[model samples]
Target: MRYERADLMTGMVQEGLQALVDGRHGDPFSILGRHQYGDLTVVRVLLPGALSVAVIESETGKVMAELEPIHEAGIFAGLVGSPVPYKLRIEWPDAIQETEDPYSYPPLLGELDLHLISQGTHYELGRTLGAIPMEIDGVDGVRFSVWAPNAQRVSVVGDFNAWDGRRNPMRLRAQAGIWELFIPRLTHGERYKFELLDAHGNLLPQRADPVARSSEASPSTASIIASSKPFRWNDADWLASQAKDRTREGAMSVYEVHLGSWVRIAEEGNRSLDWVELSQRLVPYVKKLGFTHIEMLPIMEHPFGGSWGYQPLGLFAPTGRHGTPEDFAYFIDRCHEEGIGVILDWVPAHFPTDVWGLARFDGTALYEHADPREGFHKDWNTLIYNLGRNEVKGFLIASALEWLEHFHVDALRVDAVASMLYRDYSRNEGEWIPNQYGGRENLESVEFFKHLNSIIHDRCPHAFTVAEESTAWPGVTNSVENGGLGFDFKWNMGWMHDTLHYVSDDPVYRKYEHGSMTFGMIYAYSERFMLPISHDEVVHGKGSLLGKMPGDAWQKLANLRAYYGFMWGHPGKKLLFMGCEIGQETEWNHDGSVVWDLLDRPEHAGIQFLIRDLNQIYAKEPALQFSDLHAEGFQWAVADDAENSVYGMLRTSEDRSSHMLVMSNMTPVPRYGYRVGVPDEGRWEVVLNTDASIYGGTNFGQMDAWAHRSPEHGKPFSVALDLPALSTVFLRWRG
Candidate 1:
């Protein structure tokens, strides 16, 4: 009986040692460290570089047993009748060290966390799944968790472990497919990544944490352990005031900026301005511009700068190119204090094919679809997310919430929404797959947007969402319950294209294309539109707004000023790119700063002053912004004046007590007397004239004109005004 027991014990020891050597042990905890065998206590350890191993009682510092080397690969085992708590005294070739066994600790992730993750309902996945600092059993450490179901093994590798995958293999949490490990003595700021082995036991590329709040700069894709220091925000009043819906009724004049190139430090090798510097510089600049909000290009972590942060790898992490996550938070807080809201351009449409990113993570299409037809983005050479998967959808939704909740972002401007809505976007025949309904619409993406918007509205009621959808998808701004995608606003791409086309033409040809300026009003009330002359219009050889004007330098400046007045006066919210305000002559270059020196010239400085005044007038006047989403707020006073290259419109307040008359003349020929109809017979004051001498334009219009009772153009009153050449005029009635 004793020999039979001895053989059984020997077999168990051999199996444990072989499993350790092969790296195939599903539960290293069961075989490693100390265990009791009836009357005897056995201790085993696998120290890859150790020359000898001794089992010592942790409390008394007494050696319990010297382990015998059972394998040449540093597998040691011995009998030790020690107390419950013990440590391993490992002797290397040159040094000695003592530490607790990683495998002996209890599971770091709880069952509830595993269940929530598998169910795709973990809203705070960022806090739970990433490298989170914590205190486990009075030991300071970081609890790392990741979801890599198809991986044979996932190990946390970093400087602490000498970048050795074999040093700390995470324990799998059953069918939840989550691997977790709590490494003692691990602290903040340590960079780490998941070293994965595929199902076939082949080594794959190490992947950064998908939910990392911070990451190393581009070209180095490891995720750094974020500090747990609490952020003290002074924007409590700002947050509370935003509880109401601010998209529709509130004035929204947005200034779109590309952070990296907006302003660079010339002394620092032309490096991009950090978030702290932006807080000091950008906030004051936007405030001076009178813009209600600043819509930034995607600030997520992307490897390539040429992509302009559109091809993002880290959805949850802010780009370390600017600064740490806390610095970004500070910037947002500063913006709020200055009464300027910040909106982030979020890219969930596709991700780049960087090997260290989410591409073929764990040797499988975990975050994206397996089939290239459905997963590939042909235009960008990127991979589309598999939004049909519950976890992927949840991850994206969590990303939106993370920015809004943690960073206090006011809105998410979803990028490339048109591409996300269509499966055949930018694809030829046979290059794309149809949905289950045999339609071009991407059903998964549609449902994902609905879910995402619904959750955001429920949790962050103050925040809003905008879609960069160029297509005329019906009900984009409608609520989800009405079978719509549920965006608060959609970019009026049609308006942008038509207006740019119209303005680019000479006055001789503009009369023939009169519908270009009038076509937007046909459906202006659809989907709560935002008229955006975004970065897309000024980049990629599409010259600057000023360059697009087909005239000499003076006419070009005059045309730009006229267009600005027209856009500000037109129905819907406004979004102008950074350099467009100052009439940047060159196309946007992501590598260079805005033409700040251009402000020294009166022509450029005048445009800047005009934009500031336009914002102030737009915000102060209710007729221009109060009922922008409703058709009742706008009416054409002279829509059929294409023959004279002139257009006039009337914007009325909600109560119908006040109104503003806006008229634009496309030609450079000044009209001495142009009859413009008014809403009431009274003194119509010219509040803003784009041709004012203050704006570097030929001052040729009166400040105030009396409207006689003589009816014209189907109105009760008429005013003979001196319309300036190639300029727009704003007239406020004092009835």
Candidate 2:
């Protein structure tokens, strides 16, 4: 019976040691580190290049035992008296080194963190999942973690380990699918990537940390171990003001900028300015131009710069092209201190499919859908995020919060929202899948948006979200509790399309398309809108906003000036892409900086001055800012004047105590005596005239007009004035 008793078949230990040598061990912590082998304190370590190893007391630095080579791969093991605080003293051919053993410590990830991460509700992943620097058992090192559920094994590999996966295989918390390891003596600024074997034990390309806070610049894709030390903030006043502005009723004139080419150092290989330089130069420029906010094109780290950050991979990291993450934070703090709100263009709709990215993670369709119909974006050649996965949704939510809460960004302009809202977006009928209800609407994405928006509003009340949805999606800016997606604003793409088309036609032909200019008011109040002249309108051979005008150089400047006047005077807040303000004559080049030399020309400089004045007027007038979201704030004074190409819009305050009239004449023929209706009777002074010579126009419009109590164009008060050729005038009325 004693011989039949299976003597604890200890062959599994040999197999585990073999697996450790092969770097295929799934649980490194179980076999390595300080383990009690039935009263014998056994210590095992994998130091690939070490010729000799000694276990030493961590405090006194006394060598306790010499470890013999267990395998040719340089793994060493020895039985000490008992488990005590210790460090590894190793000798290489060229050098001898001493450091704390990585595997000597217990798991640092907590039970609550594991539970929240598994449930896909860990909003603070920036602190949880990435390579975090911490001290474990009085030993200083970095705790690296990643979530790759189907990986047979995962390792933290970097220069320190000679990029060898076998040196630092991690421990998997099976319930959460996260593999973690704490490597002693590792500190900030170390570059690392995760090497994983697929569930089939086939090696895959190393991947950058999905929650990395810092990344190497484009063309190089290593994740950097960043210092988690908090930035010293000086924007408490700005935050307090934002908290008081729950309604966000003030004017919002956003200057859309692409940091890469906004300005470049022509002498320094045409390199873009760093964050410090931008804070010194770009911030003052935008503020001087009277812009209230600056919306940067996605600053997220991406592999290709030409995509202009529209296709991004590192959502949690600001691109290293500009500067370090702290430098970016300083830039934001500077913007707030200068009273300029900062908005980051966020791309949660999709991620580029780089092998080292989140695509095919763990040899599975992890962050994206397995099926092409639901996962691929043919137009962009990118992979759509699988928001249907609760974990992925949580990941993106945590990414957004990283910006809103950690970076103190004022807003997020969610890009390509239309793509997320529809399953068949930019696809043929057979190339798409339907929801459970057999509908084209992406129901999972809808729920994700509602959930994300609700969480964001509940947590960060001082910040808001805007949607770049091209479609007429209902309730885009409505509250989630009212069955809406709960965005604060939506881009007015229809107005941009219709008005750009109207302004590009010859004056005689413009009369035929006059309805294009006035049709926006028909449904303007359906959703809160921001009329965006975005970077999309300026790039990819579309030409500059100025180049789109149909006329001679002088007339083109006048046309653009009139359009800006009309846009600023019209309903909704404003957003103008860079280079448009100075009337850039060429299509935007992502590789080059803005043509600041264009300002040397009188016509171009005129356009710049015109935009500055328009922004000032928009901000100074409460009727233009606060009365934007409701129909009661607007009324048509002249809508059916296609023959004369004249349209009049009367903007009134919510209390009706203040009013302004915007009369736009699309034709070049001067109307010596044109009459337009106004809301009040008295003097209606021309607050702004786009025709003034300072803005490169004929300068032939009346300075002011008298509004009599006579009915004209369905209003009680009528105003008579000489309307300039191709001009928009803002007539402020006071009784």
lDDT of 2 by residue, 242-279 (tens): 97787777788999999999999999899999999999
Q: Which candidate is the best by TM-score?
A: 2
| Model 2 residue 312 distance off true place after TM-score fit, in angstroms | 0.8
By TM-score, how accurate is candidate 2? 0.98
For the record, the alpha-carbon RMSD of candidate 1 to the native fold, in angstroms, is: 2.2
TM-score, per-candidate, Cα-based: 0.96, 0.98
Q: Write the per-residue lDDT of candidate 1 for residues 1-735, one digit (tens) a residue.
A: 233334323336677557656765556666666666666777777677788988888788799888887778767777777546777888988888887666667777778878778777778887888899988666678889888888888888998777777667788887788888888778899999998888888888888999888999987889999977778999988888887655558689999999999998899899999999999999999999999999999999999999999999999989999999999999999999999999999999999999888998889999988999989887799999998887788788889999999889999999999999999899999989999989999988888899889989989877999999999889999999998999999999999999999999998999999989989999998779899998998899998989999889999999999999999989999999999999999999999999999999998999999999999999989899865787998889888888888899899998988899999998998877799788788899889999998899988875688999988888888999888999999999898
RMSD (Å) per prediction: 2.2, 2.2
Candidate 2's C-alpha runs over 4 A off are 1-12
Poorest 10 consecutive residues by lDDT, candidate 1: 1-10
The CA-based lDDT of model 2 is what?
0.89
Q: State the displacement of the C-alpha of residue 196, model 2, in Å, after optimal TM-score superposition.
A: 0.6
- Per-residue error for 115 in candidate 2, Å, reads 1.4
